[model samples]
Target: MFIPFQPLRTSSLSKKAPTSVGRVVAITGGSGFIGGHLLDALIADDTVSRIYVMDIAPTTRWCEKVTFVYTNLARDVQFEPQQKIDVVYHLAAVSREPGFEWNEYFDINYEGTRRLLKWASKLDIKNIVFTSTGMVFKAGPFHRAPSEVPSADTAYGISKALAEEALSGWQQSKRGRHVAVVRPGAVFGRGCGGNFVNLHRALRLGTFAYIGGPDTVKSCIYVKDLVALMRGAAELKGWHVLHGTYPQAPTIGEICNAFCKVFGWTRVIPTVPLNLALRAAAPLQMLNELGFSNPVHKRRVEKLHYSTDIDGSGLLELNLAPTHSLVEAIQDWRDECAPADPH
Candidate 1:
């Protein structure tokens, strides 16, 4: 149900009220993996008085401070929060998963953001924290800077880049508005079910192998650290874009070895040449095109060889260095999993 926007109640308090008092916050995709963690952080924060979660899906979490609002960004829907929001966290976007069309990505990621900004303008909300992707940059050995031109080749990346442009325009149109864009790399943690989970499963099943070499850089950040940076970004007062990844980018082999060491497995994973692996995966790719669902794909194989190194110096400059290293983060995930492994 679309919650109609309610006007803020007038009081004897001044219009130029300080945020030192508790602030009301709204999140676009609070049901998502990262958004769930962000909600936890806000619940524990003394500076936040209330939270409004707006998404197509209902949040699994229930708290006294949270009110879930059903809203779909992909559709042209009217939505206004019940409370006057001080900050909006835009975390809703479609990932570049299999079978998603180009228009779907554009409509949801680019146009969805435009719709959100329109609502925010009406509420007179000044601060926005958007979660973009490191895929906006080209994959390579060298670290990618935040200011560098976006070299997005996929539909998801292009849509996010366009959304960033729209946010920049919004920030410039107003005098006191602030927008902070965080382009994060592969994020993994307790509740994550992305590449890291697949990697762990592969390692445990003895199906994991090194493609090309052992030194292909894999830029990533723990989800907890990423949300912390997102919270910090909401407090900044200008247009800012930051890359979210470790300063010391970990290699794929190093990641695999870390998994082994943590799990106490002494199995030596084998290495396969890129060309040979591609050739072997070609048949599976053809099968995928023929409507068979399988894990092996040419694109997935190719990505395993490319390095996704990104520069996260901007995070450090903002005093938002991640609290956990790669190993420590892995250990934490292990602990969170407990007797039930990530697989």
Candidate 2:
């Protein structure tokens, strides 16, 4: 018996991931920025046999060479995964926006994941790669290392925690499924559509602002590195939790300085504190979740106060090279905003 709770499908992919060529893998949210990269990476690898992209968004790119399945994880729909997916990359979630109603958060983030796992179990899938966020950590000082336990206070975090717990329970059943949870810090890059986009807007127009205190540090990862981590997890897993962060995380101030140096600017202003931002964001975020086009209160700002970090040693062990350096990424961002070089 399969319980399908959520019925929404989105294709989330990244930029640098190679194409799928020989291996068969099913990725929820394949159309997304990072997920797209996963699809591209898989398709490019001749070792990969086939690639399945499950999501609501139609495959704007590479629709011919790949298997595109339209379905939502938030619902219990009976659709077959592309032929024998040895690896399932679960990247779909609902926290990108702010101020969602409690139930919507549960349905999309929490129950959505539960249904995905159930579907995978039914298929007897072997390896599962879950893309998680650093939001699972409670309000506290930065973590120098990944802990044995998991935690989350808000609906988004709570939902991911519940999913992890469910997966862990399944693992204890001595099932063949190998699950890996990757917690990434502030993920940033070109073409990214989340929190960092706002930062990019600031750089483009010179209105970027920092949240929380100057001491607050946010762990970060280049999207390419994250894709590498996902590939590693796809290859191996044992109820593991790895942080997809660079060994060195940058504080808001440090990030600001990097941008400033790139733009030859003088200063970056500090935004409101996390708590206040949440309060102010709540009303607006809720309004936006009502399906408004641009709501100011985004769900991501809820915990933008303190710095966040997760250990990268596990990812390092998998032999993944870091993609863009802070200097390079920042420079690229600045160049993009400046008037085109009149060459």
Candidate 3:
């Protein structure tokens, strides 16, 4: 019997993770940042016998158990599994924004998902975990709230949302197949040059300055926590979908201040009003719309003024806990990716 997705609510322990012991797993895009971390975790698990990595290229991080299979979802890539894959983590997608063409985005992101689903149908892979972005939710006053509706305001987000729809359709068409779509918000950590990477670099070099009041709330999840979420998703039965973010999202100002304290930077970052910043970046925004690459594009500037507050209640309802703290995770990132100057 197939259970349709419902808004997550408190359920009994019957909804707990099914045993993954002695399961053979496959991860698409396992060469990427989050996938690599997940691969590491899977390798460490004694229960998992073999790990299959399906990507365009091989992962730089080498392990004895991990077998890298060269597969491109864009093409007619053949997926002949040596062993039946009990769980497959679909993490591959074109996440780049602004620079990519519409066709390219849809082809890689949306179509890639379709190809995977087709392969899954052939292999009868019941458990699948797909990584979608929090950007699928439209930006508005609900930034500080849980995003209930699945809508995309950007090309990248639209592509992911469509991929999610494809997954939903696949589940509906079959029985005993479980799918989990995890919408992670601003995932950051070692080896991840996400939104926080630029912020960290600028702050380290004393060039990080906020144009608008840095009070915009942004939800974030550490990569390790994301891995945990993926593990939970793979084990959970039925079709589940939820946002993966910090329970209480911190504001931009709060994030900056925390970093300052951590790095021992005594200087206060400057901030201007939203209107002033928008006025200054208007010309740049116009140029960007005309196909020019503008660093201060209107969309980029708008993100700073708005809130992306995420609700983690869904995760709680599933009884999955994110162990890492934001500051601690950021500190780890700095130590590995960007070390502080001991001046």
Candidate 4:
């Protein structure tokens, strides 16, 4: 089950202030996993007067402070905010999910950003915080830095890189225009049904095993920390590209151990050679394509072995530190999943 996207009971931001002195913010993809967390933070912030959410779908949770607008970024839709938007948090993008064609990624990830910039330009909005991915760098056994030239290989990565270029051009077009590009590593938390969720499920089912070895670094950041970084990045002046990940990169083994510890599981996780695992997962991939809902995928198996040791030292320069450690993050996630208290 996924965690519900609701307003956070407590946050780092100050208590709500009167609408007169708060900033009016707009967010794209506010219904998504990361965007939901950002929404929670903004809702708790006293400095934020109102929030306008632009997306095709409505958010599960709603409040008086937030207004949902049915705006499709991929298409040329009429989006005229009633109030002047102070800041825009651009988090909408097509991810590398199954069945998405290259054109879909190009339309939503690349062209959508261009369209958003056009709208922002028209509204005279100066601040924009965009959520890019660490996938913009070539995936391999090397540490990737924010400053290093992006050598993106995947379609999703290429589209985001183009979007970033568009944002850079937008920033350079006018004086006092600020854009903060946040490239985050694997972001995992309660609502994320991605790699970490898959790992947890496989472990609970007694089907998880270390691919190749136990030492491959899997650079990651918690969802809350990532949104916090995005908020902090928006505060900085000028164009800034920041890498969002923990200071210490945790290995796959360490991640698995932390999950086990959180759930109080004692079974030892086995290791399988990469080649053998790939061969085993090939049939499962075929079965999945043939309408069988197989949990195992060849791509996921390969991703487990590849190390993504991204450098997130840029966080230190900006005086932004992640609130939770790996173990702490996993434990917090577990707590979120617990049954609600009955009166």
What are the models' TM-scores? 0.91, 0.80, 0.86, 0.91
Runs off by more than 4 Å, candidate 2? 1-21, 203-206, 209-212, 268-302, 332-343
How many residue pairs in model 2 have overlapping backbones? 59
lDDT of each: 0.84, 0.69, 0.78, 0.83
- The alpha-carbon lDDT assigned to residue 39 of candidate 3 equals 85
Clashing pairs in 1: none
- Candidate 1 lDDT over 1-343, as tens digits, reads 1123343335312234333457899998998889988988888888788787888887776665667777899776476555578999999989745448889999989999998998888889999999999988767666788888888877888999999999999999999999999999899987788689989999999998999888999889999899999999998989999888887778999899888888988777888999999999999989988999888877688778988887887677789868898888898889877988862
Candidate 4 local distance difference test against the native: 0.83
Residue 131's lDDT within candidate 2 is 89
Off by over 4 Å in 4: 1-19, 340-343
What C-alpha lDDT, on a 0 to 100 scale, does residue 156 get in candidate 2? Answer: 75
Q: Output the lDDT of residue 342, model 4.
A: 8
**What ordering of candidates by lDDT runs from best to worst?**
1, 4, 3, 2
Tens digits of per-residue lDDT, candidate 4, 86-137, equal 8899998888544478789889999999999988988899999999998888
Error of 1 at 226 (Å): 0.7
Model 2 residue 59 lDDT?
A: 53
